[model samples]
Target: MIPRLKAWWRMFDTFTQRCLAVSVVLAIVASACLVQLVNVQLLDGRTTAEAATNSRTSKVTLSAKRGRILDTNGTVLAQSVERYNIIGVPDAATSFTPVTCGSKQAKSLGYCHAIDDKPVGATGAAAVARLLAPLLGMDAMELGAKLNGTNQYVVLKKEVTPQVKREIDKLNLGGIVYGELSSERVYAENTLIGALLGGVDDEGKGASGLESSLDDELAGTDGYTVYQRGNGGEVIPGTVTKTQEATDGKDVSLTIDADVDWYVKKVLSEGVSAQHAQWGVAVVQDVQTGEIIALEDSDSIQAGSDEAKLGSSRAVSQTFEPGSVGKIPALAAIMQSGVKITDQFTIPYEMEKDGQKFHDASSHGAEHWTLAGILQNSSNVGMITAAANVTNQQRYDMLCKFGIGQSTGLNLPGESNGVLTSPESWDTRSKETVLFGQGYTVNALQLTRAVSVIATGGINRQQSLIKSVSTSNGKQTSKLNTSATRVIDENTANEIKNAMESVADRWNKVINVSGYRIAMKTGTAEVAGDSGALTSIVADTVGFLPADNPRFVVTVVMKDPAGVHGGTTAGKVFAQIGEFLMQKYDVPNSAERTDAIPVEW
Candidate 1:
């Protein structure tokens, strides 16, 4: 068998054996190629295709629209408007050519630059400058200089209106000119509530004021889109692979009334100027709801301006000794401790107690006066005498309950909590001074809320400026979860109201409002001046109108005024604002004070 096999192998010639060996090698190579082709085309096909598509695709950020800041009446205070930054490709502009007339694309172009029915003679950057100058309100020479740079991309103009951008697009300079979407924050009321509304940064984020505190609610979620782009850097049509819709921010509605705020500011500025005061602040709040209807400062700050970035609402930031106005809380504590409104005391111009001497604002002989008369005349000596009934701890507790040295719950930026030391920290003179509102300090809003307790039937409610927030779905009222606590009984509040009414009656000539009864108290404290000396005075008045049926509480504070007494300077300003409020709200005339409490024996 082996000999037969060897004989058969010799049957083929050398040339045929060599050709057959080459043919076998070629078949093995073909089989290897087929296996590789199957692996590449089937196993890794989807991944390879995706990688190729991703190379040409780009992701673009879609900015979410910022919400509007609205007043109580639905008036737009602050808003964001769509705008564009005109972009120029300087390198591309060098090859720009003017469009020809009678062309299909030219027919649709509303305004075209042409000479003798021919395209503009200028070419390159000059042509682009000439065509865009009129639309962009720029000088042709300057624009040409900017477009002649070697930079591939340059911002030609920033924050142009959408209408202007459309006109620029009509030029049909696709590669040379384009637009980048942007937004411009506009304040409709300008200086009205400017500092309170605050301003935003270059990235459109809130930088100060209520704008900063409520930034999260005002700045919605930003979306994005992934799409393929051509070599020219333009998005290819129908190539959007993925997109996420932007969620617009919710509109913030404030409890403030624009008209009331304007009037209060006008009155406050005039009063501050009249007295040659350093600065002034005023606040108006609803008695029942604790809504701040008006917050004003003497110096107006324009929103989005340099000044707005430097300061905020002084009504909540500036703190000073409340002076005699501070006496109300101490007196209330004394009254609640079984001291009758008609309780009699022999008051003098000055007196010594606990080794500390105290005096009234005026020098007078010893006279008999009741608790009501003591507050009406604002006698410091009489107050200290009455404060004897309540302990220092009781006095401090009342002041704390009145919101002294505590947060206003407004969440306003830069707000000061004011200074209120505990009874344990009080010295001999501090204890006596605390009785007449001299040792502790409070801001305008805090003082306003302190007085409002009487008007609210002895209940202390949390104050708020924000009314509600509106989204795409609908409007949702702001749930502040404000706490309300009973500071005194209704009877005690009425007694205090009657006493404050007597104080207003004594100042009838200074704070008179026709057909209206106002319960009021004035304050005067000596504070450190700019020179850091205790020479400056803070004169202020706080009260609620229609004293019998309280509605609104108004407070006015003047720093370093010519007239140091709160009753004369701040009192006059209060009258003007009170009169306007009556007419604005159409409030009913106050009933005659038939049950007036006797201020004297």
Candidate 2:
């Protein structure tokens, strides 16, 4: 073959030989380039395909649904709902057209046609705005102006209805998009449980009340997804590359009884309005477990209204001198010091201590009475006489033991531990004043817990608002605190319970049901003005039902009401609630009658 090729080359001219050699070299170079092209297009196909898809795709952060807040009876107080944001890409929408539709122009444009327009029609930004304006309840001109802007992403409207979304889909507009998200905290009961359930802020975070305190448990983990986007910035079907499933937040159940809370709020609202007071609070707790069934704050901010400056959980956050209600704990302290309920003393209308005189709510001549009589009459002088048995430090310590000067451990945000001065901070007058429910302060919940000492046989159980937290994975975590510590002896608690029965007997016309034996105490404490002088009254009533074996402890507090006495103002509201609860729970009356305690001996 070499001899034949040499013989053929000798016959060609010099120009011909040079041209043939150049042609062979050029053909070799072309063959090498073709091989490299095949390697990139076929052998490394996946890498090239990925890079192409990535240029037109994006990752979107999907929000997880917030958990529901349900009452003990399974009534939902707060929940989350799916809402859609009407999104528009102004630059894209200005020149967009839906080229595909059902059985239209299949040969001309290779697919379908626009659903709302004719074949080869104009379906640009102005046309899209005209079709969507009436459906979206917006002016066509206004929508056109928005679509003419330079923004990459624009929110035309938010919280669009599902029905409206379906209608928009029927048009099949190319540039219009729907960005889905969760609604901001839909309250099932509206303002009824407003403050208690709290409100979610703009960042989807709980801002106050139980929502604020248990935000992490209620806010679930958000999910994410990466998908290829079409030319118009919309997610393409079947182009999702990566996905992480979203895990929803955990559900919360509170000890609150919705029915009981409704009734309590009803009566409190009426009372507060009738008295023309600043606000009112009503709290009902189970004596045995310290479960707060109803904690109604009448001054709660209305949902969607900018009415108040602070959250309305005044039942646990606001404090005032407990007045006559303080006597309940005082008698317990005196009894703890070996002063029997029947112990007699000569009580005067007013008594001077450290140059300051203390008097009862009403002035009368000096009279002789037993320990039970002092509490029944709410006599300040009688209490001062009994204070000699226990030291000031001992009384302060006793009050603290009953959950005063401390939070109730109920897990409520912004809870207050009232004004309780230590023994070292006591003035000379505090020794006498503290004995009669003064020189110290307590919130309505603290007073109710203090009164619970008598109802729960002296065991101070920890107060709780949460019953359980249930997750999306079927696991539940209980939040109830059943632990309790003894604050007084059983005998002392029973003795005070019996004595308070007399006070309830007197308020029976308003608070008593036809079949139940009730025990109660009325409080009328003076609230100091901003100038540090007594100016307003904190009328309140704290008590329990069925003097024999207590079931419910209800406290009603009215601030700066028309009536200064709790027996008349707060007692009316308490009576209405007590009657409702007795009927609602169908609680049985005591089989035995309350034994009369000797008032005078």
**True lDDT of residue 464, candidate 2:** 77
- In the range 1-601, model 2's lDDT, one tens digit per residue, is 9999999999999999999999999999999999989998899888999799877787877888888888998898888777667877787777766565554554565554342455534456776677678778999779888888667678787777777777776665654655556555677553565666667776677777777788899988889999988875678999898899888889999999988888788889999999898889889998878888998878656532333214646666788888888888778888888899999989999878778877888888888889998888889889988878699878888888877777787767667888887889888888777776788888888888988888998889888789899988868888889999999989888888888988887777766666778788998878787688888788898889867878899999988999778998999888788788888888886776737888887
Off by over 4 Å in 1: 1-56, 100-126, 139-153, 230-235, 480-482
Candidate 2 residues lying further than 4 Å off, grouped into runs, are 1-51, 98-123, 139-142, 149-152, 232-238, 303-312, 473-475, 530-532
Taking all chains together, the TM-score of candidate 2 against the true structure is 0.87
lDDT of 1 at 151: 80
User: Model 1: number of clashes?
Assistant: 0
Tens-digit lDDT track of model 1 for 422-459: 89999999988887778888998999999999999899
Error of 2 at 421 (Å): 1.6
- TM-score list, all predictions: 0.87, 0.87
> Listing every candidate in turn, what is its Cα RMSD in Å to the true structure after a full C-alpha superposition?
6.5, 5.0
Supply the global lDDT for candidate 1.
Answer: 0.88
Model 1: residue 213 alpha-carbon error in angstroms: 0.8
